[model samples]
Target: MKDIILNFGPPEELETKRILEVRSLSYLERLERLMAIIEVSHTLNTAKIIQTKKR
Candidate 1:
C-alpha cells in the first residue's frame, strides 16, 4: 500500500474545493489499476508523480 499527498493551488484559499477533489479522484483511479490500494491525502508539500512498468 502507498500513501500520496496531492498539493494543488497556491496559498490563497479558493472558494470551491471541487478542483482538488476531481484531481484526487483521477489520480486514485489511475493508480488503483497499478497498485493494490490507493489513498489520497491533502498536504502542502510538493507532489510526486511515479511511473511503474511491469517486466
Candidate 2:
C-alpha cells in the first residue's frame, strides 16, 4: 500500500478520477440521447411493420 501510494500518490489519483468523471459526463449524456432516439425509432418501425402486416 505504501509502495502504491509512492508510485502514483493517493490525492493525484483521486483528482485524475474526478477530472475523468467530469469529462465523461457529456459523453454519457450524448449516449443517453442516442439511446432514446433509437428507442423511438424502433417503436415507429414496429408500428409500420404491424400496419403493413395487417393490410
Candidate 3:
C-alpha cells in the first residue's frame, strides 16, 4: 500500500487532488484499491446483516 498523506482543503480542491493522485497510479494499483473497497463494503454489509438477525 502506498503511504497516505492527509490533506485539508475545500471539498472541490480535495476531490480534484484525489482524482489526480488516483490517475497517477498504475492499473494494478487502482484495481487493488477497488478490490479493497469492495471487501470493506462487503464486510460492513455482513456485519449489518448479523446485527439485524440478532435483533
lDDT of 1: 0.48
Top lDDT: which candidate number? 3
Better of 1 and 3 by TM-score: 3
- Regarding TM-score, does 1 or 2 come out ahead? 2
Q: What is the C-alpha lDDT of each candidate?
A: 0.48, 0.77, 0.95
- RMSD for each model, in Å, please? 13.0, 13.0, 1.0
In terms of TM-score, which candidate is strongest? 3
Clash pairs of candidate 2? none
Compare candidates 2 and 3 on TM-score and give the better one.
3
lDDT per residue for candidate 3 within 1-55, as digits (tens), equals: 6597889999999999999999999999999999999999999999999999999
- Give the 10-residue window scoring lowest on summed lDDT in candidate 1: 42-51
lDDT: which is higher, 1 or 3? Answer: 3
lDDT of 1 by residue, 1-55 (tens): 3486565786554425645754667666757744633233322122332222322
Better of 1 and 2 by lDDT: 2
Model 3, runs deviating above 4 Å: none
Model 2 worst lDDT run, 10 consecutive residues: 1-10
